[model samples]
Target: MVLDFGFLKTEMMGEIDACCDHGMMIWVDDPWIASFLPFTSREASAEVMQQYRAEVRETGQKLIEGPFGKTLLLSQVPTAENLAKHWFRRLAPRVRLRSGNRADLLSVVVWETPNCMATYHAPDLGRSRPGLSPRHSHSEKFPNEIGGIAGEGGNLGSHERSTFSQRF
Candidate 1:
């Protein structure tokens, strides 16, 4: 099972199969993805915390209606960090399971804030990848990739000067 960084291009069936077959939970910081999940009952919902499924669903739908759905504004920094964290959390537990050491069971706990990005926590892991945002318009491979407008010195452009100021 792969917890990918970018949106998985495949259909929903593949994601469902991953969850059912390998216990792969596809949680995203982006709320637009959440609107599709139905949470009438607790057990089958996508939320890490069962209680918040309905809230998540509503927030996702709102974001979908908002500009984030139409725009390509995705934060590459956050995406990569979350991706690495997901892999680390999943891999460590699988290793522990295979080694017959069940003492250190771990799960990726994601807290999704309504109308905002989600946050996840895992124990004892860190990674650093510099100058790698998809928004770096200078990249020939990722031209015009939107979101996270880092200007001079890798800081965000001045709010007054930035095109995203109004939306942000």
Candidate 2:
């Protein structure tokens, strides 16, 4: 069902089969969709969870009509240390196992709010790049990209450090 559904019936079969065949349940939560699911019967609907898993398996092929549904691919698993900049809404976690099909074992846990993780984590406006932001990028690249007070010494210092030809 996961490999052949609507527009999802394509090369996605390989990825779906692989995950189903291996990639043992590493983590699971329901803060809203998965971790934050409600205690009510509606929120715990097996059908809803089944659909969610199918969409995750289908990934790029699946078309969903929700908030994060449009940007699902760009999201998920980041290599940077700035995951707190995004928001994830969990819906369902568990599903009903239909006959002749496999049931996946997923662990359910909640996420800790970034602010709650520390007593006094500093608020960062963020940099443009590693160890630097647009505000400071000029200092390292252009050096004298910005001008200083009447005679506080800005580009003058930058030029003094380098010859006219080198500055070019």
Candidate 3:
């Protein structure tokens, strides 16, 4: 599938108190932005990364100075799922605008860790399910592998296994 990758800086905190306060260096790499423009994937990823870094730096500063302290201020809770949807909403329109409506954004997967992730599929593309396929079956492509490795004999726990199954 057409793919692009980027990063976003965010933080999470309590609704009223600063308990469980922490920052998130979110990574959005799998099934990313696709452009029909002349730029290569490397160039596109670099540009997107640069733009997002600038936004994160500026907005993060504002949020830090605001009443919320260092949290990534949002209307909804800054969970991984919400962050994925947030990035999808922010990027999809730009993709359509830049590609002249030639690109189809299948989904945006936000990785909270190496294994844990949250995916946001394009509803307009008939992606009603969370991790199903509208293009091709991932199982057919990699019949006996998880993350391109033969068998599941790594440090993969149940959560990682489930995530890999849904992703690859």
Report, for all candidates in order, the number of backbone clashes. 0, 16, 0
TM-score of 2: 0.20
Better of 2 and 3 by TM-score: 3
Off by over 4 Å in 2: 1-35, 42-44, 60-168
Name the 10 consecutive residues with the lowest summed lDDT in model 1: 159-168
- Candidate with maximal lDDT: 3
Candidate 3 lDDT by residue in tens digits, 46-116 = 79556645665554311332223333334345677876566566555554444344343445555667667
- Give per-residue CA lDDT, model 1, range 117-142, as digits (tens): 32233333212123323222122343
CA lDDT for candidate 2: 0.24
Supply candidate 3's per-residue lDDT for 141.
Answer: 44
Best by TM-score: 3
Which segments of candidate 3 are over 4 A away from where they belong?
A: 1-71, 126-168
Cα RMSD for predicted model 1 = 16.4
Instruction: Rank the candidate models, highest TM-score first.
Output: 3, 1, 2
TM-score between candidate 3 and the true structure: 0.39
